[model samples]
Target: MVRGRDVILEALENLNEDEFKRFKHRLGTQPLRKGFSSIPRGTLHSLDRLDLTDKIVCYYLEDYGMELTAEVLRAIGMLEEAVRLQQAAGQV
Candidate 1:
């Protein structure tokens, strides 16, 4: 079976540099719901896109990683990537 990290990596890989930067910005800055924290700027600072995706998956686990990733994608106007992620994960 395809891992959630694989799905997330694919989505991130599809983004151009600017979009990927925006996505990381959102992850570092967005206000998450209660009990959930945004990724720290320091944490985000050191990682490239692939590492960031891995961090998200490991930190949030598969399910929440999928949701949070899609949410961030949509927040940055990447609806197609969000949908594709959900579909790939069989959540659509």
Candidate 2:
């Protein structure tokens, strides 16, 4: 079953860099979706959660199917190695 997080995850996955930047700019102004509220709202170092969110989104821009997991790994700065392992494992 598709959940609200799934929808937001898909949307983030599809957005391009420019589109994501615009989206971030408009995020506070946009009407809140019930789905988005559940995402954690803090920062790591000086980076906003939205920045990590966008990276996760961008990571799936190609044919990558592991968007959610990849992005979470990316958020913590481990996406590259993880993708490499995924590729080595023939999972990507």
Candidate 3:
């Protein structure tokens, strides 16, 4: 069976660039409540459209301090890029 990471990667690979760009933009502008038990319905719906699993979505929300584009890199296993983004965000 595929691991969750692989499944997430596969889903991400299929995301069209334009859609992902719009989603990232929306995520950046939205304010998330702490702990991520729930989020704005619109954000949740957008995540669903991106085919992000609940775990991945939760990870993004919990680490919402970083930009969504950066989280996308991290989620897709681009550690170096994610680190760069973290540094850019002053999280590192």
Candidate 4:
């Protein structure tokens, strides 16, 4: 199975330069700054899109830390999105 990091990386590869910049800017909350160093820029954008508040990111990063790696973070995020999608579909 493809790892989460791979999924995130794949997503990054697909974005145009402007899109990528927008992604980065979305993550500008000060609280998330600590994690900004651990993850790659592309993954940062993904987190931003997910709208993980600075507090949430800090909480998760504090507990799990940067060890999540690129693949794992992507995988987890994708899984969360999938679950949300499934739930939304069920509501229809």
Candidate 3's TM-score reads 0.32
Candidate 2 per-residue lDDT, tens place, 1-92, comes to 44323434444445565544444444323333243332232322233344544543453332332334334334444545436434533422
How much is the lDDT of residue 19 in candidate 4?
57
User: Which digits, one per residue and each the tens of the lDDT, describe model 4 over residues 1-92?
Assistant: 43333333344444456654643543333234344544444546666433433423454442232222222333434444334333333333
Which stretches of candidate 1 lie above 4 Å from their native place?
A: none
Residue-level lDDT tens digits of model 1 in 5-55: 888989989999999989888888776666677677888877887898889
List the global CA lDDT of all models. 0.86, 0.40, 0.49, 0.39
Predict model 2's lDDT versus the native.
0.40
After superposition, which runs of candidate 4 have C-alpha atoms over 4 Å from their true positions?
30-92
- Candidate 2 vs 4: which has more TM-score: 2
- Candidate 2 residue pairs in clash (backbone atoms < 3 Å): none
lDDT accuracy of residue 14 in candidate 2? 54
Winner on lDDT between 2 and 4 is 2
lDDT of 3 by residue, 1-92 (tens): 33334434443454566655554554455544565443455554556443454544455632353455455555555666556555544522
Which residue ranges in model 3 land beyond 4 Å of their true spot?
Answer: 29-34, 37-92
How many steric clashes between backbone atoms does each model show?
0, 0, 0, 4
